[model samples]
Target chain A: MTSSTPASAWSRDDTGITVTVSGAWITSRLDQVGWPKAERSDIAGQVVVVDFQKIETLDSNGALVLHRWIEQLRKSAATVELRHPPAFYERITDAYAQSRTGATSPPTGRWGDSLAEIGHRAIDLAKATLHLLSFQGQIAVKLAQTLVRPRQLRAKSVVHHMQAAGVSALPIVGLLSFLLGVVTAYQGADQLARFGAQIFTVNVVGIGVLREMGALITAIVVAGRSASAFAAQIGTMKINEEIDAMRVIGLDPITVLVIPRVLALCLMFPFMVIFADALGILGGAIMATLALDISFGQFLRQFQTGVPILHFWVGLSKAPLFAMAIAAIGCQQGLMVGQDAASVGIRTTAAVVQAIFFVIVIDAGMSIFVSILGV
Target chain B: MPFIEQNFAEPKPEMMPAVRVRGLRTQFGAQVIHDNLDLTINRGEVFGLVGGSGTGKSVLVRTIIGLLRPAAGQIEVFGQNTQANSAAAQALRRQWGIMFQDGALFSSLTVSENIDVPLKEHTRLRAADRRAIIALKLQLAGLDPSAGAKYPAELSGGMRKRAGLARALALDPKIVFLDEPTAGLDPIGAAHFDQLVLDLQAALGLTVVMITHDLDSLYTACNRIGVILKKQLIAGTIAEISARPDPWINDYFNGPRGRAAAFAGAA
Candidate 1:
């Protein structure tokens, strides 16, 4: 036990030879020890024994190193025997031997396996979609019931969630929307100037920013920010058994956790749309004035006269639906989190992806419906 | 030649106590969990830390394992100050293993991979060798070799605790700390776990510090028990503790539940 370094000694006797391995024959010490290399000449027609009794420690690495040497000696016509292996070395050696013979390889049915895997994944996706839809229906019922009895509504929680999901998300939404407007205005100015129609850039920028880019950018940003945050917060509460505790205390998690968040997002999305629309138009105006040599007042007058008020209303109408989709998807994913720490991370990522995808799909449908109605 | 001879002739440093705590104080905002608490765990002893709920048993373990910083006082493991961010403290970490309540296994990693984590971090062993070690550690923890490929979530509560124990013992640590090792287990399972701890301790000469509420485990495995009360630790043998006149300790040990557990332990 005092020796930090592992060592071995060989002794020859009339009956056989004994190799006593001693002093921490662990994986970390294997490199330090000089492994005994047996020769056929010495081992032929004799018995060889490897003793591990004196070893301070013997892990799998040490056992394998010794087992291989013993196997070699036995193959050379020597009667090899292992003596006094540490408590679990026998099991380690048996597993190592079995693995060496490829007994542990996964069974192969390549084409069938691939087909089954794909089918399994498809079914899982369908099941997950159904579950999410059911959760959405439950939330809708809860929303209606609360609307019927407004006193039961958690107003403070709704306001708190608004501050978290909406107020805190303004800067990023504003920045991205402004950048989008600038890029669109710059690109449109190039095409319009080529046709001697530079003033038309204002109409293009105003319509695109007010009717599409402003609302779309804000939804995507909120989906990324608030959806993931809601999922992580709820998933952690589930893991900590706080959700169960809330149930025991006679509180509905949907009422306390889900409703407030969904309502907050729905209320905030329109305000965010308005704010982003202003910033985006301002960005377009600035670009037009500088890039096209148009005066600021001229750009403003053209933007105001060219973009119809109906287009702005059409864009604002999509905000509440987009908000509801994002919030519902996020809360549903959170509630679906399994009782494990890693499930929290997986569900959070899924919440963000699903929320963004749903938001885009809704926006596309809204755009088609508005155009069909001649808005 | 004389200098080399002198260096070679010096005696090795004596092994220090497994754990030592002096004037340890911990607090959370206005709450004081432990104030001026002191403890010493000698080498090669099964030390039990017992206390009422909310007495900071888990917190104390966390503090000693360097997870939580003490508000005041010093902790030393193997003569190295645990609070210092020094190389010696890093080396000292390899000397002890900890098993948390509920196993706390990484849900993503299979049982074998969980055991392999410490081996991979601390050694330069080949993959084959590491695999062999994983298998060995699994068997030592009384688990089937087939359990290696399963995730922590797949294992039952008792099996998860065994897997956690396997991971803890991976590095051949001199000391092992178990937080509530037998909680949430059936009597048979808890007894089996106790026997496993005893067998492993005997085989490895490990100094075990376990926080447990099971009186059966206390009577069966512990050589000494440290009770936490009034923000302080009172250490003694089980018999000594049972003899104390403190109302809580008296009811806890001589109560009907305690008597049944003691009888079971004796059997």
Candidate 2:
């Protein structure tokens, strides 16, 4: 690769043309540096000299160049002589000579170095992983320092994340949770109709949406929204060295950066869950009122009596825990970023994956604990 | 008591040598950066440690500030062993500040917010007081008042360095660690940085441990010079080292670039 480039890059004085491989249409070497056609032409009227010396390597280009010149020279009744060629080039000519006599030799340049390129890439990735670890330490120190010393909150940033995690999320969470409630109510109304127990549909839909599905749906929505938000935000900061700067100034990025976002999510998630639950329950009530022919007052009364406060608080408690898990995973992944753009991508992937994994595992455990303890 | 009597009889402890690093050694895997390095920087002195890339000059300064842990050796800051995780070691470090090669200013934070960070974290100053302090420090560092609202990315390279300097001296730190403070600057910018360092040192009464390869920086600012080579710090006064024939020093100072810097300074 190295040698072949310089060969074609320079021009011979007599021939005044660059040499590159063409005939073989593969990795073929040039055998020798024949005198540039002029010297030989001067020596013998029919003599032609082609400089294979500059043709260290050739593809179709060298072959075409040779073919064109040789064809022209042959028409002129000139004989071509080869000069000093590399050993590899001699092997090529010898094989061509043998092949002309029906001799056997394998071909060159059939996807060569593909496996080597793959291996080289794998080794680079592994080395990069090790290099990334040092950067993690630098980031961790920055986090620690930022923590030891607290700084003013970025009102703009906090508001931005707040709007994304809470304000913007309202429609989606509202749509899904509310629709789930309506479906619950519709199904309940259908079941109760057989026994003339249609009014009980209000209690069923209300309790179900508010207690279990409301919180569950809210959490799932947040796992996708806020968790990923944390990952992208922290990851961007990591790539840009904002986290490191935070440390130099003795500000704990985690306590300052992560804590605020986590805290915001913690406070907002449960409220969002409640808000989503209210919307969902209202949706269920609407479905019930329409299907069961139950009035709003009747539906409200049934719902208030059926679902206990314990159910409400149980789901709300998990919001902060989910917030903690998301923050920890996202910030940890961000701090793990290296000195390159790829590290941010890798860490962001890790953040989302880890956040979702922990949220599920912890949520399941919490649900069980709450149920077992009769909360 | 008279001012002279008070100054002489009970000299400030900073003047008694603020940062003393002795027999410092650190390594990353098989590569030993600093070994058996000893350095003592007096208060109000701009001590320059110069060496080529990978010569451990930066490593030595980082080791002093407790950024990179030393594999072997003792670092005493304000007469306390800084390597230990004791309260005293941490307190000693609080008296020092560092400016990294790239300025290392918080891109997300505005200039005033960046400078106000140290005060907000360490002291119990009111927000107004902190703002006042930040403004004063910014003024002292030769940065404009309006720059406080600008982020690191928004500022010029020279402005970034100045803002970083303001952050470093925000708490009136006695010892300032500078790692390639003037690196990546144009000639005029670099000269301006060197003069700013001199002005800062004089105004703040700071002891600076600067890791730099800029020959002009060494001449303009440093009181004592040190070279980190072959995993050891060779320290001497500027004149003392000029008289010596150390290969690294010869190559650095007597080399073409070094001689050119000297000639420029002379002119």
lDDT of all predictions: 0.86, 0.69
Off by over 4 Å in 1: A9-16, A39-45, A52-77, A82-111, A129-135, A149-152, A241-256, A287-293, B1-15, B23-36, B71-74, B84-86, B229-231, B245-248, B254-267
lDDT of 2 by residue, B162-205 (tens): 88888987766768888888888898888888888887676445
lDDT of 2 by residue, A1-375 (tens): 123322222244564333332222221222332324334343344444445554434422133334444545555444555554445444333322332343223346567578888999999889756654554465446545545664554456666667777778889999999899889888888888999998788778766776667767777777777666676778788778788898999976765676667556666777788888889988988887776688889888877787777767776777777766666666667766665456667777777776777778877898788779976
What TM-score do all the candidates reach, one by one?
0.85, 0.45
The candidate that wins on lDDT is 1
Pairs in steric clash, model 1: none
Residue A152 lDDT in model 2? Answer: 51
- What tens-digit string does per-residue lDDT give for candidate 1 at B1-267? 566656554233246678889999999998999999999998888999999999999999999999999999999887778999987788778778899897888877899999999888987767876777676677778888788898987899999999999999887787899999999999999999999999888766789999999999999999899999899999999989989999999989999999988787678
Task: Tell me the TM-score of chain B in each candidate.
Answer: 0.94, 0.90
